[model samples]
Target: MNFDNLKNIYQFAEHFQKEEYWQNLFQHQSSNPLPITNSPSIKNSNIFPVCDMYQKNNYFYIDMELPGMDSNKIQVNLLDNNIIEVKGYYRSLQENCAYYLKERQNLQFIKQIALPNRVEERNLQFSYKNGIYTIYFRQN
Candidate 1:
């Protein structure tokens, strides 16, 4: 090929290489957006008082501290792309009982978590005990 053709071919190959590199990088780094606590259930403003998440062998465990809440009041949902949402409410005492000082939070709260990897939706499980909500999922 002539010198001009050779140069043109080289330039096209260089451009293709740059595009491929960027595509690969994006594919590797792109991940689902993490869930945010923007939605608050008015009935329960003190939702998700404390939350923690960890991963083990083929499993993801989410533990949340939800004091003064009954088992029936809390709702847990798993969304597409491995997002977990916890929604619940806490009841307030009707009568004003005399107390020296009360500093505990009692309101509705909503917490959302983004999973590290896709999980089996059907295999999800939840347990509530001692005012703690624990959610378990099998990794996909």
Candidate 2:
């Protein structure tokens, strides 16, 4: 066996040996979540919220960044059994405060997450704690 081939084999074996590898593979919805015929929403639609996801057993964990936003304003929905949609706007309650530097104070984000496996629409759960948004889904 050539050195390159042996390296590839060793990497494959190492990947399979780690539980995190499997978890990460399933977490991002089977390696890719690219949608066919992409659609745009809200101006500057190119910006997407940074996120982290993980899969364990049959549960999918999604951690999305949505700082300074009220939980009541956020919306989470399941579409067609595989697509997860998140929509929300952050409106500051303070009206009298004037700032010279204002950035990301008022924000809105709409993003769809695709799952490789079927999900129960009613079983989804979400929690926002300390500027982090965490959503959960179970594979069906």
Candidate 3:
């Protein structure tokens, strides 16, 4: 075979190998029942709230740490397919007042996450207290 033909065959084989590897990885992840932890981190630097989610029986529980946020400012929306959107604005009380030092960030942020399983839209529950937001969902 010519040099150009040989190079094309090698590239085709490499592409095929990568495709097979990715197919196997996806199959392994799907067949296993274990939860997938540690997804890619968000690129936002505005100190968005942290959240922990777990499934128990037919319900999913999500607890978020929202320090320095008021309950009235938080907004929750139940989108299609177990996706929830949490949005809120954080404004410093001393925005107008002169401050010597300021560490906290004053801005608006939104976080949206998809749950492992689908949930009943009407059965969703939410509670905010002590700088924490607890969201509960029941499976349909």
Candidate 4:
């Protein structure tokens, strides 16, 4: 029919094709972790710790930046699925003081990570040292 109508049809088909391509690319596997939703603790805070994940010697390692955080304040858990969740609270030392410029504040944070492979819950371990929180998992 009209050239403009043909162009519109082409664009509509391209949009659906693009969406289908991504859906195929991101199709979830049995080992894939589910989506992460914002918890109440994270909804009001903008703090998300930087992290790195790697594998070595049949083990998966996750290292997260949590400067000035104590081991007691951090908790780690392996979900029933293949996700590892890290949760912690940070209390600002200057909470009682008012400053013209303040960047850090008391906050609760949650970070979820999908393991490269399935890991046994009993083999999960973690340690916090020198502002780095490390999680270890033996590949199953």
Candidate 5:
């Protein structure tokens, strides 16, 4: 191919790589953008909360975003001394009536992570701040 053709191909690829093209291509066409919390009953669609885990310096951390959730609704448990389980329910509706049962399905999320090593369970601490759960552990 001539240099002109090569230049044109490069330009096409460069344009395709732009953020706007990809964003428009992947944009959901639905008028109502459904979040994971909106449709827990969707078949084959996993709505589990996303998490980030890592070890830094003297602490191992597992963080998950849980916006609009009450801290009291969340439960954390350490299983088998090595596996940690985080469970919670998030509700968007507040009316307490059986009539809404069919219309409202609370968003429940659970995430479990296995520790790389035994941790000081007695000293392990966690905090929920700024719409995130942060579990901290120091290696035993």
Candidate 6:
């Protein structure tokens, strides 16, 4: 509660507030990092949505958490047979509202996921439930 304690607390908060701090902390812990293509429309490579890719029951699935995101605003494109690009924006529930602790901000995000094998035969589908978007591919 003293001046030095308050100063130290402020310094700690300032350090965590830096974008680099969070980026380095969560720096792509996945064993296989997907290759992201640079495009003029997308910005901020740091805005990566947590994703998991796996195969089960003859289906290749990519489940990505996009909390509070509008389904209408999301776009999933098959860049190729083995690569997919997901583009979307997170919108706040209220406009011009002041937030004391806002972890999720209104920002654009583009995430590309590379599959282990090419999903030919054109059987692709997706579903969103409980803020998690699951993309399904029929394994041939």
TM-scores, one per candidate: 0.58, 0.60, 0.58, 0.61, 0.56, 0.63
- Worst lDDT run of 10 residues, candidate 3, spans 38-47
lDDT value for model 1: 0.66
Query: Would you list the clashing residue pairs of candidate 5?
Result: none
What's the CA error at residue 42 for candidate 1, in Å? 15
Q: After superposition, how far is residue 35 of candidate 6 from its true place, in Å?
A: 31
What local lDDT does model 6 show for residue 127? 90
- Residue 13 of model 3 has an lDDT of 54
The number of clashing residue pairs in model 2 is 0
Candidate 6 clash figure, as a count:
0
Is 4 or 5 the stronger prediction by lDDT? 4
lDDT score, candidate 4: 0.72
Segments of candidate 1 deviating more than 4 angstroms: 1-47, 92-96
Worst 10 residues of 1 by lDDT: 38-47
User: How far does residue 17 in candidate 5 sit from its true spot (Å)?
Assistant: 20
**Order by lDDT, highest first:** 4, 6, 2, 3, 5, 1
Local distance difference test scores for all models: 0.66, 0.70, 0.70, 0.72, 0.68, 0.71
Candidate 2 ranges beyond 4 A from true positions: 1-43, 92-94
lDDT of 6 at 20: 66
Which candidate, 1 or 5, has the higher lDDT?
A: 5
How many backbone clashes can be found in candidate 3? Answer: 0
Candidate with the larger TM-score of 2 and 4: 4
Candidate 2 at residue 15, lDDT? 54
Model 5 RMSD to the real structure? 12.8
Candidate 4: stretches off by over 4 Å: 1-47
Q: Number of backbone collisions per candidate, in order? A: 9, 0, 0, 0, 0, 0
Question: lDDT per residue, candidate 5, 1-140, as tens digits?
Answer: 33644565565566667786676667788863532222123221232466788888978888887777888788888889588888877676767555634643467666667788876568678899998878888866
lDDT of 3 at 9: 50
Residue 38 in candidate 2, Cα distance off native in Å:
19
